[model samples]
Target: MALLAYRDKHILSAQQLRKLSEHKYSCFSASLLDPLLQPWWNWLVSQTPLWLAPNLITIVGLILNVVTTLILICYSPNGVEAPPRWTCLLCALGLFIYQSLDSIDGKQARRTNTSSPLGELFDHGCDSISTVFVALSACISCQLGHYPNWLFFQCFCAIALFYCAHWQTYVSGTMRFGRIDVTEAQFSIIAIHLVSAALGPEIWLTKIPIVGLSWNYTILVFITFGYTLNIINFLKMFTEGGSGKNGSSVAVSIASTSRNNEAKNNYETCMKT
Candidate 1:
């Protein structure tokens, strides 16, 4: 077939493929707490059947998010109805499931020795899309939707922060998840869900008066913290000369060195096996 011929013509060479895989793995800059959670994650990954592909796990997470999106749409219905209190519980549970699955897929790949460039691309792409689901859920949970501006701002800030973090990774060869990574973000959103269920959605809508502003939004304060961390990271990168003429080589060197260490560890572990 013509399609088969085109695919064959564009297939990557072995060297190119290896470099691509290395690049994919190098893009991750984990959170400080990742190690604290690693044991638990390793256990979870060990429990996963080898027959289950990493990409399948990723799809399961995406499906959970889609279900959550539908539930939000039904409960909010064009934002005309304040979602019932129980909706918060549903969203929290969905996010928990999605986050857990998301965390496990990479481990699954490593365990199976099935890691690939495509898997990394698929994982990041899914995470980016899930950001929207989490954003809308946050707006619904906090009842911030009542104020359109706040709702829009919350969604925009969440997605923008995610983008900026990855962009930093791409340019600086380090994706700093900081003390607060996507996992922490998920936990915080879950907390918001519980608070909304307990105190009612309008609770976060209450604004405290600030000196310069008529009122300060709680969600705004939360987002400001996220932005501040990213700004600090950008400054650190700038100071390191990662922003200079040698940026590309430096970034590649950083990624290569990290990957080399990881590969060495993996090889040693395999020999022990």
Candidate 2:
């Protein structure tokens, strides 16, 4: 109960705040969702059906991501103008769903004693795969809306840099990713939604008497920032390899086992089915 109220005002729950404290990272939608997610996470853990099932939710998210990609691809190459509002809205919805499910499985595991080595590997592996889905969809959507091809390349740069930086962070340490500090990655994806939202005449930024200026520069400004952030993170790890590490987060490999034992012991003490 206290945790719920604390989370309401704090922006991130204790787990997330602790994660960031450990890893110290940021991203857009990730920051926003930090507050709303914990309650759902706690609830998921409390439920037997929803407890730490990695393959199920991960696949669901993957499929939705694919659906979003396909929608964008359908629009790509044609450069059609004034695509329906519903199309843009639908894509936004897909992205929203993606964010909601992103961190739940891990939370579920920790809370419910479902954590395991196989689960960790599956979750991390799928995260890498999902990055591809975002880039492909963004490129296709822009093309379909008659947007610039450059946008897709910008997306590519951001994703590539992030991908490299993530692996680099792990390599510099114990080859592990933190659950809480995932804000940076999610915000990176949010950059896509922000830029993709720009579709019409007002999309321009500047007005020169002879030359017209538009918001692309503003949008590009965000793109540049995202890329820069990736570079900075990569460099930090490249130079120092992130705090020399106590060790790899190898404990998480046995997290599931730990949880199961705890649950069993609790049941024995309680004598309840």
Output the number of the TM-score-best candidate: 1
User: TM-score of every model?
Assistant: 0.76, 0.60
**Among all candidates shown, the one with the greatest lDDT:** 1
lDDT of model 1 at residue 113?
Answer: 90
Worst 10 residues of 2 by lDDT: 244-253
Q: Please, what are the lDDT tens digits per residue for candidate 2 over residues 1-273? A: 999888798787675455444542222333554676668656654563653365677778777877865665565434344334344446656766666566676666666666665666677677777777665554443332345666666667756765774566454534433333355445544554445565532233334445343444445556668667656766666655543334322233234455787799999989965
What is the Cα-based TM-score of model 2?
A: 0.60
lDDT of 1 by residue, 1-273 (tens): 999999988999775677776664554546766777778878888899999999999989888876876787688855436677777777788887888899999889988999987888899999999998888887777665567876777788778877876667666655556666777778888887777677766565565556343122555675778777777776666456354245653456666776788899999999999
Model 1 TM-score relative to the real fold? 0.76
Regions more than 4 Å wrong, model 1: 1-18, 21-24, 27-32, 78-80, 206-216, 235-245, 249-273
What does the lDDT read for residue 73 in candidate 1?
66
On a 0 to 100 scale, what is the lDDT of residue 160 in model 2? Answer: 75
